[model samples]
Target: MAIAEALLAASPQSACTAMIDFSGRVSKNPKLDIRAPGKLSLSHLLGWQGYRMLALLLSDVLALKMAWQIAAHFNQFYSPLPPELNWGSWLRLPSLFWLFAAATLLFFAYGGLYSSATQWKNYLRAGKLVSMVYLLSLVMGYFYDPKLDPPRSLFFTAWFGSVVLVIGFRLLTTLILRQFEQSQSPIPVFLIAPGDRLATLSHLLEQQLNFKGQSASHYQVVGAALATTAHTPTTVQTILASKAKEVLVENLPDTALASALYWQLRRHGITLRLLPSSVDMLHRRGLPEIFAGLPTLRVEPRFLSSLEYGLKRSIDVFGALVGVILLSPLFVAVAIASRLSSPGPIFFRQERMGLHGKVFHMWKFRTMVTEAEALQAQLEACNEIKGGVMFKIRHDPRITRFGRFLRSTSIDELPQLFNVLLGQMSLVGPRPLPLRDVERFDTWHHIRHQVLPGITGLWQVSGRSDIADFGDAVRLDLYYIDNWSLNLDLDILVETCRIVLFGKGAY
Candidate 1:
């Protein structure tokens, strides 16, 4: 309660002004305010609020139940104790047993176990809590009633059983709530942003926030304050006319404007939030924090940590090794075909820019004529794609007969396994572009090099050559960088298989 109060108090009222560069056209009329989505009574809120209480009650009951069951199992297995030395006997001493159970619950609650706001949060907190409770119970038993406590060998079994029971109860509850939400009530949301920012916010909300019966039904755009360049009113009334339950401001460069916006929204009894900046959006950073007595918002970057990188590398090496072994026959066959069909080396080696702009030799099975690079300039007029980076004809005349089959099957990229094993590439990540392509990239495009390049990535699986827009390509790469996770990588791998089998977007 104290923490929640402190957090609420730390957030201050802010005033905001929305400005538009409308081709320097000045209008005497005020900009119209539009309403989008507002808060709604969500069914999930009921489940979220009551889950902690239910979890605690369930944990206590399950722990006791498991304790008794384990005690019975121990008596059956190691029968130095009589059959009567079970839960029934323990229940006769109800005062002692209940006291221990109460202590366990208290210990769990104190360890920040029952304060979770989400299902994953609950499970993680519960696991920690149950472990703490088990340790406390063991300590208390060792000190107070060693003789009554079960054998040390059974301690782990009892602890394991209790954890399963607690986790099982939470999972079951989550399943029930999910099913109910899927069948019935809609999730409610309020969207607040400037007119220009509303479209992007709406797209995001539709993708992430629209749930079941509730969609973003209301959107409110706060109009600019009526004032000259110098001395604008920084109060809530000057900006917002209608009462907003939540306020979301687009990323404003002026701290004064941002602070003013926050103040005005809060003054109108609204919960203030800021639309993530382009940097934040690209990095996928979560909510900003409100520090005590500070008007400034501090947002933490949500990039993959070093530990995550290490885990990804481990998976890469393991997967690459397996792939190399499993696909060696295909590799041999492609090598023979390339050598027979082309007059050059079986493998085409080219320098490509990798992580941190480092240059490395990338290998691919020869998929074009020996003079394909020389023919690129002549074929420029025939190029179908429009971009600074080079993309040849999909059915380029320079490609060898067998090269077409190799390119379609993605067998041409097999030599990249050597690059993966060399720590120059990953099994999944942004594609490493040639140095020529990297040189042509603008400042924002350099972000793809922040991580090691991959053999198959978001681009390859997300339509590859089919996507003609360079901006979309860069966005996909940025999305992969920002949202990189083991599970996401696995999903990409699965998608890659489907893409390969169908050769959907291959040239």
Candidate 2:
């Protein structure tokens, strides 16, 4: 790529500079035309993210006050003290309470509670930080006065209350602020991808803007360029000219192309979202280590976070059970509509590859005619997926009028909650492939089957049926497995809900 070579030319010590020819090609020569943008000042940092952080900080302060009052109330009831020593009865809080609250705020700030980059919805993180602050305080107290008899009731109550209240208030704060964020300006974004992906990525971003509206931070694609030009002087100039605050990269080649582009954009305070392909993604999962005094990238096959995985499974079962109960009425309505729309059973059960290639019957509300399976052979030519591995069409003959509605809204997949309940699926993982699609998969594609299938996944929320290439979809699935976290799962679930609600990409 031209960008890789441009990096060396753009270096401060290099005699040969970079130049962009009229043909849109980067050439190594004297005097590069690229102008490095100035570093962002502290004033520029206070955007929407800054305002959100301030709001969260205000919530934390209020939560700490409430927790202190609650702890004091319970402590007084349990163990009354003499009037002179009863500081809880004072007009202002005891000096100890103020000191502890100040320490708690400092700990929270250090824990990234007020950072915009931290997951705002991660209530667990806030609770953990609160607990840590209290634990540290207790340890310090023990060392300070070993013989002093501290009020156990007040100390324990304050610690527990702080944790619970902080998390509760943070959740409330996030919900309230979300309503006000809609009026904010859309984030200007530049797009970078291979020629084939340029249109696809643009359409996906446009779809998100149209469907979700302003419920989320909307992005406007102010500029686009070939991924090959990513780190080139011309690309930098174009991005700067467009005044894009963020750049979304798709399938960028694995090389210095990324490093150079990152540094180039970082200097200008632009965020780079590199949604790399499978090979680069696999490289990302490796942990840097030293073997025999030589640096190496160690890729472990098994995840060491057993406790988190257990928590994930617990959430899956609980969420699935609750979903089934809550959506039973919608299920009944869809089943009735399906029966009246087509001459077929209300449910469709098809064999799908699950974890470790275990075959299971995946359930869905029937959205096609009874003869849909037999008719597949005739419709193969109409498959819209880039590779023949997966079958998809923008419009199919087998779908009944009502079936279209079901498929678009993803109501057809509601029955998969039962699969999740049976441990055949997760609420968030890779989408299981039909036996027909799996049969045509390349060797590497089977890696996705290493985890339980899900009713909704990265693939569903990223682009759904709009994604034409089976390989791109598989890359997203692999990315999910390699970087799985509770916060990531929550992010996917939230995006899935928004996409499904708007019926943006599904056929």
Candidate 3:
């Protein structure tokens, strides 16, 4: 295509001599029709995406040089190049290092590292890519230079350092780019789905917001067209008036209608994307293929391996220790307040369902009378939040005067750091439930207990005690588990702090 385009662009007649279909068959296109489906204007095609790959390649090479210098600093045989001198040293990397640089970039590209539009934001995947590149480099080195005259330590340190530096560079660059991007207007989008599913689809799209719901002052939903086409003229007018750049069609509509709509919408140059037929099962990544002219998606395995669990536990331990130390003063203050204001033990320990329904003593700073649990049955009839496995009562009689304050402030949850440190919980996971609540849970409800519980979770941060529907809470937990990553944990932690500090939805 590039060759054809160049030939046409250079021709005196300014006409194309041939058109190549996807089948590799050459045909006449004397009319210079370049609007083929798989082709685009060269400038637009080579825009930011090509530049992004080049930038990543440069970053990887720089990371390689930095890794080598840092590794060499620790090796007894090599003299480390100082910072000012390293500028020229990077350009003079050993001939073998040049080979390594090319291989690293190619390996990363092969590993899907260079493909992410927001590479820095996808740190976990990028980290895995870095490890792959490093491992590949090690294997290459072993075969190509077995003796490793520069020292094996050099390669090892460089491997670790490349991961750190490459990620760090991407992280900082992503932040800057994200800030710049937010200033630009979002492309208008038209949603074509069953009216009943509009609300759910809206919420899903808004999750792509910078800050879900709140900071989303501007909405990308420019218009809506019902799949049923109840009012065809209205839908067409809305689409035309809104000038939507994209149309999202739900899988509910028949292919004939989707095809008709696509033909009508494509005339306006609106990109069309069909919503997955099975949104639930496609929550994680999948292998996309074509089967007999129809798109096919195969779901990937959802289980976490032992190594992932071990890494998750290690992070939980470290985060818990840091949190406990940082909040020791608040913990002591809450403990003292609980004893003085509630006339109960400083800590409240109750048997709660942990992983796989294993009972564990979940600890919290007492935020109720000593006999609050005993009074729970009496107040059952008056429970304000209904139709949920968990029970809650507005203006409960059992909450002590200070207990109310403690609960509202979420200080009651401070002691859970100990549970996290003890390995009975994680810093971010499904919140553990009391045995009474567990007893009321259905079989499907037991799924939340598959992972260690936490003090703060998707439910707590999303709506906290305000969420009355047990099924809704369970769904959020499952979604978290299915898509678990370090970025998600950080997001939840930040959101939890915001909710706790604002006293939103707390009793």
Best by TM-score: 1
lDDT of 1 by residue, 175-281 (tens): 76565544442222233333344455545444433223343332333322221110123224333343333433444433223122332232233444444442244
Q: In model 2, which runs have C-alpha deviations exceeding 4 angstroms? A: 1-132, 135-292, 296-304
Looking at model 1, residue 327 earns an lDDT score of 93
Question: Candidate 3, residues 1-507: lDDT per residue as tens digits?
Answer: 222223224443321222112111121221111111222324322544345555666776777778767776776466543332233344665555676667666656644456433332566766677688677766775797676534456657777887898788777666665555556565566666665566555655554443323244333767664555511434555676776655555653332231123333432334455456734433244344322122434222111112344566677888889988999998887777667775768888999877655678988877788899988988888866556478888799888898889889888887888988877778888888887887777645665654567878898887887888888888788667655656688789899999888999889
lDDT for residue 297 in candidate 2, whole number 0-100: 39
Tell me model 1's lDDT, rounded to 2 decimals.
0.57
Q: Each model's RMSD to truth, in Å?
A: 16.0, 18.8, 20.2
* Candidate 2 structure quality by residue, lDDT tens digits, 1-507: 233233333434331233222211232221221112334535335887668878887898889878878877878778864343244543666566666777877766645466424345668978887888788877887798665445788778878888888898988888887787777787777777776666666666655433334322466778877665564666787888888876766666543232235535544555556552413643564444332122333332221123356677889999999999999999888877777777879999999987666778999988888899999999999998997999998889999899888888898898999999988888998898898998898755765665677888999998998899999998887677656767788899999999988998988
Lowest summed-lDDT stretch of 10 residues in model 2?
A: 27-36
The alpha-carbon lDDT assigned to residue 457 of candidate 3 equals 86
Q: Which candidate would rank higher by lDDT, 1 or 3?
A: 3
Q: Scored by Cα lDDT, where does model 2 land?
A: 0.69
Worst 10 residues of 3 by lDDT: 18-27
Check candidate 2 and list the clashing pairs. Answer: none
Alpha-carbon deviation at 128 in model 2, angstroms: 11
**Each candidate's lDDT (Cα)?**
0.57, 0.69, 0.60
